[model samples]
Target: MKEVKVEKLLINYKTLEEFKRFKEYGHQELSMLEDLQSNIVENDSESPFYGVYYGGSLIARMSLYKVDKKYDQYFEPQHDYLELWKLEVLPHYRGKGYGKSLVDYAKGYNLPIKTNPRVNSHGFWERMKFQKATYEMERDFGQNPLIWLPEGISERNTQ
Candidate 1:
């Protein structure tokens, strides 16, 4: 397989149109569109959405958000971390390493990462070396979170 390039998606109608092809397209994207129409966010401004394109069409995407230390509950030493969500590769693009490419891109940050894997995707996250976060009723709130820790970082002990 050729190298996959994960890119930061620009917030624009074209990008939005491309996103509709994704199954995960819903509130997150609709809100972005509304924000664009209302001038809440500029068309080409930086966005949390990132994607992989194939033949000039978006084939995979994920959103990465930096959560402040004060809100960090998954990593030891309480530092800033990335919250990864909405990772999806179009049906035809699955198994081509596009999903792994997007994940590998997130790991490039070298920060502890957290994500709630979609049902049946636990195996994939496990393959990426992410471990299940210890459940804490208040923090977890029924979401089964998986986490990846970078060098020198450890999972926070929740008790």
Candidate 2:
């Protein structure tokens, strides 16, 4: 299997246009567009998005944000970690390992990662070795989060 290069995406008109092809396009993307249009952020400003491009087209993408340890409520150590979101591969590009490649790229950071799986994506997250976090009413209200921990890290005792 050939490796797919996951590059950090920049916030630009071209990049935003490419994002329209993704199924997860929503308010976050629209907010970026608004920021660009208003010049509140520069055209090529760095974004939290990472993606795989094939033949010059974005085929897979995800957003990763680092959360400070102080705000951490998911992992045992209470250290800084990554919160991954918006992982998607274009419909035509599914099952080609593009999604896995994007996920592997995030795992390369070696930080514990958390993501709220979309409905029906449980199998994928399980395949990725993520476990459903024990739900806490106040902390996880309206969300079901799955988490991946690097060696020696474990989920905090949510019981």
Candidate 3:
């Protein structure tokens, strides 16, 4: 498999246009566009989005946000963690490891990661060594979160 370079996408019209090709485009992206149009943010501002381009076209992407420890209820020791969302690969890019590569890049941070995966993606997350976090009504209402913990870390039981 060819190595795909994951890059931190900047907030720009061109980058927003490329995002339209992704299926997960929604409010977060719209908010960015609004910020750009209103000049509230400068072009090329750093965004939380990271992606892999194929032949210069973005073929896969994900949004990773860091949640401070004070807001963490998913792990033991109450440490900061990554909240990964909107991970999507173009239909043609499936099975080529583009998604996995992006995930691996996230794991390189060495912080515990959390993601509420889309329906039917359980197998992929499982294959990535993530396990379903025990659900808590107040903390996890309407979300089924999966988590990946680095060595010497474990989930806090919410049951």
Candidate 4:
């Protein structure tokens, strides 16, 4: 496998088409298409979505959204953190480290990161050193959240 490069994606027809192949395709893709066509977002605007292409085809992808410090619920001192989502590697590309590479790119930011991973991905997140936050009935309702904190930061008080 060749080294993969993670790029911030643009909302274009091609990108939209490749997105259809992923199981997570739904509101997010629709929203981007609407935003792009209405000029609410420029065609090549910087998006939180990132992906790796194999031979001119996008095969794996993820999205990372930075949360404002004021709204942060999972880190001490209320610093900005990344919320990672929609991490998927095509079936044919599984086990080749594409998913791991996308995750590693998110880690490169060196910020506290959180993800409500797809149910089947627990082992992958564990291997990536992510740990489940201490359960909070109110805050974590209906979701199992996993998080990674860079050295200087800390997990928030879930109470």
Candidate that would win on lDDT: 3
State the lDDT at 131 in candidate 2: 89
- The 10-residue segment of model 2 with minimum total lDDT is 27-36
lDDT by residue for model 2 (1-159), tens: 687899988777777778666635443532333433443255567678788999999878787899998988878878788989878877788889898998899999999999987778889889999988884437677788888999988888867
TM-score of every candidate: 0.87, 0.86, 0.86, 0.84
Q: Candidates 2 and 4: which is better by TM-score?
A: 2
Cα shift from native, residue 113, model 4 (Å): 0.4
At residue 157, what lDDT does model 2 achieve?
86
Badly placed stretches (over 4 Å) of model 1 are 24-40, 135-139
How well is each residue in 62-158 modelled by candidate 4, as lDDT tens digits? 8789988888767888889898977877778889999889989999989888888776789999999999987333666677999988898888775
* Candidate 3: tens digits of C-alpha lDDT, residues 1-159: 977799988777787778766635443532333433443265566578888999999888888899999988878888899988878887788989999999999999999999988878899999999998884437666778889999988898766
What total of clashing residue pairs does each candidate reach?
0, 0, 0, 0
Assess candidate 2 and give its lDDT. Answer: 0.79
Per-candidate local distance difference test: 0.80, 0.79, 0.80, 0.78
